[model samples]
Target: MAFEHPYGSYNVQGSLNEWFRVNVTGNGIPAWMPSAFIHYDFPETGLISGHSGHAFSLTHQGADPIQQYQGRIVGDGQRGTLMESTLEVNCWLSREKAGGAYTHRLRHMGDMVSYIFQSARDVPLTNVYGSTTDPENVTALIRIKPANEQPVLPDPNPDIVRRRFLIDYRWLERVSAG
Candidate 1:
């Protein structure tokens, strides 16, 4: 079975290697505090590629320092304008009990980005869901159109527009007493 998790996209014009960063925060059964960074590379004639680094810290009601995970993104751009791309993230935790990597695909369109995350391994859980510690591999499809197509006038200093996107995960795992 599969589920859908959607996060909006942004429209900006720059080299593929430009550093992009986002911060995500949320509240629910288990609160989430995660920060993600995307570093795009210069546009190549054939493909536009980038890398992502993520750090997530989760806190629950009764759990101590719920869980923490970190990973990276490996993706390839299918369009000249970086319209669509696929990503794989290698994740790990401090506890070491729950640690794994996930691979996802990310697509960029105009002003919206969608992410689809899948599990790298199979588990007994009824439905596989991403967690702060064990984040499911995610593929995000984002739509982006530049605000202005024309080049800006020459100036000593230029005002650049920066956009950000955030992802939140919530779920609980039953502790096994064996």
Candidate 2:
């Protein structure tokens, strides 16, 4: 019988991420609230409350930890103490029937993670270090405006325009005060 290498290499370039998993336990998802120096971007709607605004939230239920939105770690090494399970990202819109619940997904690169969270079904979460260069992702995420709607100025926060958005986690940090 001829001897053959059963483990012969086929292709191992970008297949490593196929099994990539990380459990981020840094106080869970942050509660993002619009800063006081902010202006109304979208039209006047109940979606964004005048007080707290519509903060984003995550739910472990139905949240798949297989691919995206999967990270776990312990108190050992660079990991945390508890093995925080991944969660499903959902939002609580102040305005009824304002936002759309579209199938969201997460994308990761190295240690940095980006969410596929979108308010409307059309919008998609764009990663900062990703190649999801679909402009629709932004438009879809924001509340669609009417054709006759007045044009608005660019957001002061450049991050909002960039694929990587700024999610204010200060609220989380405050509550976690030592």
Candidate 3:
């Protein structure tokens, strides 16, 4: 996928793997999309790459009621929630940003656009979620509209609001080459 990086000037190339088990909640009731994951290649030479799981299956249930909707929102990075639910977004790794080591924008693609400004840095979980802590776990936040479209950051036009997901990059693992 190739698009302008939200934070820097670079193009994300290559297919993204399935990384980070994300929980979809907070922004909407009965969640529009399911608790899913996304994957990214370690940034190299200003060229980065990644993809949402199952980006091209064409499985979206935007119009259907919440009960009938099934998960699998991943789609091509540009489209509408009426047509496509999830999208493969542009990402970057930052050294100056305090929010996280990496950041990516998850967008609700349509005529009325909205964005989830995700920021994640390395943080070891010791006794946070459970009795056992994983070293690979990293804390991340997906900042939506009110949180994302702030004075200091670039505005994504908050008038058009959409469902957003809060992401946590836990259990860092490589996407298998199989």
Q: Which stretches of candidate 3 lie over 4 Å from their true place?
A: 1-30, 42-106, 109-133, 136-178
Mark the 10 consecutive residues where model 1 has the least summed lDDT: 8-17
- TM-score between model 2 and native: 0.18
lDDT of 1: 0.22
lDDT of 2 at 46: 39
Ranking by lDDT: 3, 1, 2
TM-score of each: 0.18, 0.18, 0.19
User: Per-residue lDDT for 1-178 in model 2, tens only?
Assistant: 5432211111010111111111222214323333211112233443334443332222222111222211323212222111112222223333222223111211111012232212111212222232213211211121111111122354464222111222211000001112
Instruction: Kindly list the per-residue Cα lDDT of model 3 for residues 12-111, writing each as its tens digit.
Output: 0111111122212224312322333233333233221223211111111112111211232323332112111122232222222212311222233210
For 109-157, candidate 1 gives per-residue lDDT tens digits of 1122222222111111221133323333333322222222122233232
Residue 9 in candidate 2 has what lDDT?
13
TM-score (C-alpha) between model 3 and the true structure: 0.19
Scored by CA lDDT, what does every candidate get? 0.22, 0.21, 0.22
